[model samples]
Target chain A: MSASSRRGVDVGALVEQARDGSPRAVARLVSMVEDASPALREVAATLAPHTGHAYVVGLTGSPGVGKSTSTNALVGAVRARGLRVGVLAVDPSSPFSGGALLGDRVRMQEHATDAGVFIRSMASRGHLGGLSWGTPQAIRVLDGAGCDVILVETVGVGQAEIEIASLADTTIVLLAPGMGDGIQAAKAGILEIADVFVVNKADRDGAQSTVRDLQGMLGLGGRYADDAHWRPPIVKTVAARNEGVDDVLAAIDAHRAWLEKTGGLRSRRRERAAREVEAIAVAALRARIGDLRGGVALDSLADQILDGKLDPYAAADALLAETSD
Target chain B: MSASSRRGVDVGALVEQARDGSPRAVARLVSMVEDASPALREVAATLAPHTGHAYVVGLTGSPGVGKSTSTNALVGAVRARGLRVGVLAVDPSSPFSGGALLGDRVRMQEHATDAGVFIRSMASRGHLGGLSWGTPQAIRVLDGAGCDVILVETVGVGQAEIEIASLADTTIVLLAPGMGDGIQAAKAGILEIADVFVVNKADRDGAQSTVRDLQGMLGLGGRYADDAHWRPPIVKTVAARNEGVDDVLAAIDAHRAWLEKTGGLRSRRRERAAREVEAIAVAALRARIGDLRGGVALDSLADQILDGKLDPYAAADALLAETSD
Candidate 1:
């Protein structure tokens, strides 16, 4: 017990190292979280006091919408201000996709040698809710490591991305010209979640109309029914050339200011924490149910349902009762 | 006690009508399941005895892969064989997609007036796991409605589609020429779950190369290392023209035969039922956790985590204990 070999590390020392800006310690902590290691409990306990400082900004859009490029540019801009940054590229795990999008990582090569910037790509191990269950924990690791800002980039087309949006202090929804993204954005309900909108590849055709279309849709959304509301601002950039990235930074800072001024930061963080706690609780319960599979309980219930002797809801009730026992 | 008004539905009568071929009744049952109405327990019970007769085939691909058109063509082919068909368009619900893909439904208009066909569109309603929690219940509804074959169509790019694939007896993964879908398919991990592959838009220039790319990948996958292994066969079709659809149907039939001969059908259905039951149980548990939000227990735990007094896992453990109590 005194040795605590299961964790295989001095968690207190690791947390101290992270707080003092050791990128290796930060990466190791994040890997522990990402892998859902048993050591996570101790790590999180150690990390608690060191968190609550980093601002999490989420960037998401369609696959070809320059999200990675924009994120790269944002990292450069953030680093220019002498602030440390962390990037978590949360790729929705495909049972077959096998790994993270390597192409997207290539764009971040510019920051590979910068100790002040930490970049990690995570793929869901097909855990209960894909990456959602583990993502918040990873963010906490970066926060504990003293990143001034953390950027979470994910493809914005699924429920997981929506969950990521709720976890963010500010969310940037990127669109590019000629992707039919304006209509697609509206169709995908991306508009409602955006704290900031970026039209990347601004040099491309129809960039202006893309912006106008977003403006038209926003006008129709009634998102700003009063002065207290924050209407998402749209910025255009050719992210490949690092054009207009500072404007993106400005938009983020402005949103952050609004969040702080309105007490939105505290409330949003509280909501994020609530959801994170709920997700963990649910995942743990799910694992208990999975444990039932080793016994005959779940199989028996499934057989009953298949045999038409019981309804699923009743079977589920019985299973839950067994779980409680 | 004799009248259960909460359901606003006579579960027994509804199930009876659904079994007797009333599309309206089937639609109502599906709606109950989709809406997660209080009556669902009774509905599932009543429908349980009447299901296990439908062969569920899942169709999935990226948005532009002509999934709806292919589904429409297959419906025609099946209808021509004089078998009743059910189509469940399980659209992954976007918070703001507003509704199902209306354009996809337009292609199915050819079967709208046919009594032998039943089609319904569903969005996730943002339930615990999105559409997944409700989908199997809805499929049971269709099976009880006397459909001989059920086609579940979904966009194949996300975790939800992967879940849909697991529910299927025979899963058909669709692709089109010029979409760079070969690489996308590999990247998305669509290759692993498919029992059948359809290369639509065969007249397009890149179609043959697409087929070759798929064959090459499949060979590299070592999916058929033994005689007992089932290799997914690729079928090319001009679905809009109703060309080569029969071959697609042939591939489906062959797979179905193989599944039945090897007792794979029973095991697959059992797995599907297990997952369905698990999803429902988890959703119930999640909802219970949500219910805690109405009290101070969850919020208090969340506050402690935010204040760095407790880690999320410990909070989750406390929350679970409270739930059990």
Candidate 2:
């Protein structure tokens, strides 16, 4: 709606401006992505060459685990090192703010006018495939826009949070005392995905105990055993007071160094690329199938299943056959 | 691994026993489903004749909004009315007890040995497509069993919970007074999926205001406005005390009745079937892609992208082509 947005900058211009680290251009580019505009493919084609440079880190924990505060602290530290930072919080907890944008913005208001930081809150709208559907593309936009670092955050409560693991190079599973026991987290499958553990709210009473619980659980796994070169480290932080925040960053830096040294970085990025592509292809196929619904073919398929003449698996096979054409 | 479980009971026998309202048979069948056993297709085929009688209901809200207590109360009320109830909690929290099953069982202990109730807590392991991957199949097993009503409860904090709405005939969104404002819920996109809203913990000070706020927000939504048949009714309850719980059931029943009268029930179920089938097909395709990874074709494509000789879209196209064969 602004005069200096998409209306002012054409598709190529927008991508170019964005790659030059213009926050407004970046915002406009992502908004286009969120809208699923026709020109998005154009943006992607344009952004293709410039991506794969930024390092993506995911911050996840259950709600009230101080993810926002930690993200704020991380941004400050990363910015102090003079790196442009991009924050994408895939929040599903707000109506007006979309992904708790208002709350996140208020929590991260210190970076409000900082030219070195670009933050966008993706509302959980058009949530296809358990993410903002356009998130990977938006990450490309930010990465293509020349951000040195991008932090992807999600509520670490459900299956959707796993998307961040696939997207990020380094995943920090932030925790607060009394959130839950270690078994709860392991069973939740967070243990497998976490590269670094941040015990946020370290001033809280159970912080040491929480750290111990996590350590004891980690010991039970072969996670850092034998073939593992880099074990996930738990860094405690009172994010509210900004204490031990630098230690957390140092842990991340260490993890990054380990990744590069072990050649795990390339594998991770390659897998991320492959996964992203597969998701897109599946989404495309889904769209094709979705378009077929309400038509006679799909309705009759539904009818046959409802009539018990066809089971769901057979019906799905038939649908897949239709798609291959 | 049990003596009389899958190792002993053949698929046909399992199906027969499950249909005879055998709790052990149902549990075994569901476990087989959770394992994604090769006999699953046979099981689904065999049980196809007996499903569709159970009226599925979904209860969801953010974690700790009293969903468990409310679900327990609803089960008690429904069972008192002579309906055999089955409960499935798709919990992503906790390591050992998926969906706080231990706590859930403790709360609903009175119904434990009733023989009419079958309770299952699905761990959010093998999280394929924002669900436990076993949920839809497990529902089929439960539906095929003799339960007259099945309740699906999920921690309504992430994208996966939306799948519940598609799977159930009616979705009840549970909220506590301090959960946040109407904007948060709306932003979370829970507004669209909820067929009914239950404000649990009504004794809290802001309880009335929560109801009022929800009512005001509902007024803004055109969800049922054009249909004019059933607007989502907000029911207040202190589920722990079991008061006002029946009203929630009544609201669900009313929604169910309206759905039946309008032919909406059939449409909803039909859509659910279609969606489930599509999800299965997509998951299968994803598995195919996964299998092909590290193979020559996928590696070359990945290399092409990394080398900047080909873009991700093109790589994805090449990958999707490989899956069809």
Candidate 3:
């Protein structure tokens, strides 16, 4: 109940420290969220009252869209407004580079001395596939810690990047000129996810063409959108030069204001919470089932499949029956 | 049981017709698989003995890399060898296009009159996010239907596309010139999934550079490959003209040879089967839990979270406890 040893800091003390804007305490809480620690339930209980104050923004696009640069730029802009900011970069470390990407995102280091900014990267270290499971919970930690806004940046590649869209109140899909066919952008479902589209590296040739292509694709209705009735505005930016970053921020602010005015913000947040609840529940059940799989029952059911005795759905029913209680 | 009518198409009858190389019957069986019909388990049992006969190849790339053209070329090559082939193009119909891309994949129509080649497209319709649940089971139906080779082509976008890499005996990752930053290839986890790399539209400027860039990146060992120590071969193809198509096929053949020679094929297939089995099981349990959610129990638990009485993980545990039986 009191501030004790650093190693065994209790949930209440850690929450207090995090709420007081201690970066170390904030990092520790997020780490706990990532690990799905036993203390997570207690931590959630403590942070409950303080949650939902922070606005969440998800920035995603094809890798090389300068998502990190834009995210860094946005953090700087937000911090300038005197609002505390948290940035979660999912898998910022490239396994192919042996983590050399750590040095490439120099703009992040430029703000290392700014206590007003908190930046963290959720790398896919040992995660073989899918986004990290702890992301939603970690966002909660940031929100509950009293940040004014949290920016989640993912290298808009892979299937998991879509998670960012569902979790964020506003989603910014970034693109770069000459980066590939505009059709690929539509194929990736980016058209459906963009609340705001940023054509980064606007100085590059074909930037206007890219914007036109995106707009043309958006005009089509086969795609999904958070607001089917609201048209997404495309903003051009030279993110590397920190040019037009403020306009992107302004678009976000405008969208947020509209959402609140229309009461869409509250509903979106509720849906987000519902999704989080469902995902957590399913993951837990999967773990329990995984534990059962270590025994002979699952194998036996699978053996029945090999023997052509039972169908997969029926066999799954049997497995669930055995493990449910 | 006899196939008296469409409604009464027995699993046994469909399997028999499909095994006899009837494309109509094969398509029907796949549809059942996709629908997750109650007969799925029964169908799996029926197909189990005849399955594993076809060599499965997965071709994936960011959309607009001429995947369909390349696939059409592969089918022609395989048919030239007098072997029957199956092609599954995942998301060939864009949700935004209302399946207009189905018409756009005109190269597929070139093989329309070829009895030895069967081509079908799976659209992304209402799949929440991630790969559709039914893809693997559909593959089983094709394999059991006596196709000598089956090609699974997915627009290299979204989380589900990774499923193609996992399911295929050999995975060919396609890329084109000017498709964005070369470094993004590494970050997207694409580098790790490719068994063979194909730089399509090889006549375009930067085609060679893309190849050089890919080779340079692959030179980096921070990747996971089917053969941990084996290097992936790169092939260049002007697929639109059908030039170098044979060379690309040669690379596939070469990779297949290496896999078979090293017993990598057997292990890869086993892993594929394991994943398929796990996915079906998980999907079934997800369905069961989804049904439970239709009742009040889940809502009450959610209410507890809103009231600050329970954490998500704890509530999930309680939900599992009540439903395990």
Candidate 4:
């Protein structure tokens, strides 16, 4: 039987269409990844050869820091350079939460008509392996679709933000003048991940101070250990007015160059792939353990722990043995 | 040899001392949990029989919503009722972040000298199974220490907060006036998890409107579809002044009573124990996967996936087989 016939989804055809620049096919592939479909293995195998082509840029900050506006502007700038761009806005809000962040995507309506630009918003909640698994799978879909650049925008919550940083080739940490994001950026461990820092809403008061604050903190953090190391640059932007966006683009390009020059890009992608593999493996193990709930294994183990006859670690050891078997 | 001689930690002595209300022993046991020490299995086994005695009350909300204040007030209320209380302030902030929340624990210091009260702050970052594994282990420590009530206070970040809700017998969601927390609550999926809601800073403007907004939303959500259902009661409090804290305590008591009357308490505990067991197992499985990174199996699989020669799911299958072996 043909590979397509073996699976519910015609993975081979869909992947071929996605590579031929069909947005519908790309969207369907991404949806399948998001849903964690049974045919995901087939989809991934089909798309594997076409990925590693897209440059992923991650933008993250607290809510209302103009992530959508900045992403929209970046898409325009990247497209001006005659490159296909994909925008993946990872909404940190719960799925049940009203789509406030998703609603913000209306600003990207200008790019809706451009065939070169694909915009999609993912609710970063309730995924099988959490956001880490679903996000990279979606990125692979876009990359397979021949995108030159993929921009990932996420609300800067603590752990989720860190996970996104690991996925991107370049990470831009956004801040606003009056948002007290300087302190928050430090608190959220954004300084360590930011390849480029964009101080959005620079037209407002305290913009210079915010920039200075970042520079001072960066110096104190000793982020630059040597002259050979690439130091993150701070770019001021008025994204709402589409101002200073070119500078942000330049910063991104500069970082990409440093990465390519140092062979950091290859190493980073290697590390990311390792994490992706590990995450999938862990999720699969967890699912197997979950499947055992239907049997007497997990419930009985839990009962033993609950009744104080066995500790959790011992029960876990029993579970591991059973699942491994 | 005794079990204590087999491990680095004298688990039996520690558990015995903690059961005798030795604060140092309780602190040591909790520290072991937080650190995920090698002796943790022994500790859990020792503490198991002593658990399932303390009632877990989770207090969570956005930063600056007075979680610490409300927690402090509730501790006092519980103390007034002659109950031994354990306050576990689970700091959801990154450990690298300045200890801003750790500073918040200063407010809980009045109970510092009280032998009946044990307050500990845990950074909810970098634990093995995220916060799920560590928090409950710490709760077990406190429960074994003879706490009648254990309060788990966490910042209402997305996933972490939901995990905390599951750990608690009663989850109290705190919101301050003018924080627009009503919309945030629904967005964070707190409405479904909240066993009781507290509108803190009731003296502030918009307190009544906040209450009304919550009531309207709760009514619309139909949380009380049947008469037997426990509709989460809204208690207004100026936690700073200790005003209305008694009412909050009463609300908690009422929820506990309802849980017991409906046999929900036993089921919830059973479910929590199951989750605890599962989390431990998952963490153990992940650790095994992590260990494989030192071998050629994981790195080679990652290299293949990075080169686009293999898909992640296929790689994961290989990893599971290797780990199982």
TM-score of each: 0.67, 0.61, 0.59, 0.69
Model 4, span A1-325: residue lDDT tens? 6655576567888888888878898888878776778788888888888888899999989988888889999999999999999988886655632365457557888888899998887766554544688888889889988999999988888687888888999999999998888899888888989989999999999999999999999999777733368789999999989899999999988898888888889888888888888888877878788899878887787777667788888888888778876
Global CA lDDT computed for model 3? 0.75
Question: In model 3, which residue pairs have backbone atoms overlapping below 3 Å?
Answer: A159-B159, A179-B179, A179-B180, A180-B179, A222-B95, A222-B96, A324-B324
Q: Which ten residues in a row have the lowest lDDT in candidate 4 chain B?
A: B93-102
Error of 3 at A253 (Å): 24
Give candidate 3 regions above 4 Å deviation: A1-31, A42-277, A288-325, B1-9, B36-41, B62-64, B96-101, B125-129, B158-161, B175-189, B201-228, B236-243, B303-311
List chain B TM-scores, each candidate: 0.89, 0.85, 0.84, 0.89
List lDDT for all candidates, in order.
Answer: 0.85, 0.80, 0.75, 0.85
Question: Where is the poorest 10-residue window by lDDT in model 3 chain B?
Answer: B124-133
**Model-by-model DockQ, in order:** 0.41, 0.28, 0.19, 0.43
The local distance difference test score of model 4 is: 0.85
Report fnat for all candidates as fractions from 0 to 1: 0.73, 0.41, 0.30, 0.76
Candidate 2 wrong stretches, greater than 4 Å: A1-273, A294-299, B1-9, B61-66, B94-99, B131-133, B158-163, B173-227, B233-250, B304-310
CA displacement after TM-score superposition, residue B321 of candidate 1 (Å): 2.9
Write down the lDDT that model 1 would get. Answer: 0.85
Q: How do the residues B1-325 of candidate 4 rate in per-residue lDDT, one tens digit apiece?
A: 6766676677898899998888898988888877778788888888888777899999999998998888888899999989999988887666632364458557878788898998887876554545677888899889878999999988888687888878999999999999999899989889889999999999999999999999999999877823368899999999999999999989988899889888888778877877888888887777778888877778788788878899888888888778766
Where's the lowest-lDDT run of ten residues in candidate 4 chain A? A93-102
iRMS for all predictions? 2.3, 2.6, 3.6, 2.5
